[model samples]
Target: MTASRFPRWVYTEGGEPDPRFTLANERTFLAWIRTALALIAGGVALEALSLPIQPGLRLVASILLLVLGLVSPLLAWFGWAASERALRCGRPLPSSRLGLLLAVGVAAVGVLVLVGVLVGPVGR
Candidate 1:
């Protein structure tokens, strides 16, 4: 649980960025958190529906989405910290790997849902 392992854990190291920029960064983080919450909610809803798909398929899809939801907040925090640091140091902002993960993960979820749908809503 060292700060080195989690940049956002150490929040006061850098010089202050412009208030507006800082506020914007905070908002961005909040938005990502919201997105994460939505994913978690969707996952729960899917599991609750107990979609007539195979039990294993429903479980796997729900678990995958839930994991993604858990990861999202961590990603948001890391991104916020990196951007804040770059702003303070006047350096180029760090690349966001989370953005790629989100895109790919969402596509994967879509595929899983499509497979379930094609298999028949009430399942075989």
Candidate 2:
């Protein structure tokens, strides 16, 4: 009996890639997931903790972090699939499109936190 892989779409088309490369791709996916979890934790912490920052800015930063967290898993899945497909098809690995966006978002969150800290709690 043939054991079927879960993602038939990814498994069906291309030749099998080296196990090492596939393992590496899986590791990358896990790393992205870890990052997503960290983002989510940060978002939760911002709201749950009573830090002395502007509430509005803190909420915005938290929302942005949560959004990034939500999107990271999609990036991880699509990135792993695309890379695995390319490896199987002997094509060059595709460059990440959303990575830059995520980086910018994280930077924006940092800036917002900085501004909130600097501005302090207003009208509290």
Candidate 3:
């Protein structure tokens, strides 16, 4: 009997890798998902709470966090699939293309928060 996997494209081409490696890849994917959830939570918090921040800046920072949150899951899935494919093919793992972008986005959010805090709420 032939076993069927959900993602045929990923499973069809490459050989099965060690189960441990596959589990590790799954863990990494979950970690990325967790990070994405944190970012999304932060965005919601910024808007939902009555924090003393410049209104416009807070909105911008919240939006930025949301965008990063949206992208992270996609990167996580791509990374997971790529790593799985490499492991099965005996090829070197691929480097993350969006990891740097995520870092920069988080940093940008930090800067926005700092500026908003320093400036205080305007027109409030």
Q: What are the models' TM-scores?
A: 0.83, 0.94, 0.94
Local distance difference test scores for all models: 0.80, 0.91, 0.90
Segments in model 3 whose C-alpha atoms lie over 4 Å from true places: 1-3
lDDT for residue 115 in candidate 2, whole number 0-100:
98
- Order the candidates by lDDT, highest first — what do you get? 2, 3, 1
Give the winner by lDDT.
2
RMSD of each: 4.3, 1.5, 1.4
Residue-wise lDDT of candidate 3 within 1-124, one digit each (tens)? Answer: 1138856667776778899999999999999999999999999999889999999999999999999999999989989989888998999999986689988999999999999999999875
Model 1: runs farther than 4 Å from truth?
1-12, 121-124
How well does candidate 3 match the true structure in TM-score terms? 0.94
Kindly give the stretch of ten consecutive residues in candidate 1 with the minimal lDDT sum: 1-10
Query: In each prediction, how many residue pairs overlap at the backbone (N, C-alpha, C within less than 3 A)?
Result: 0, 0, 0
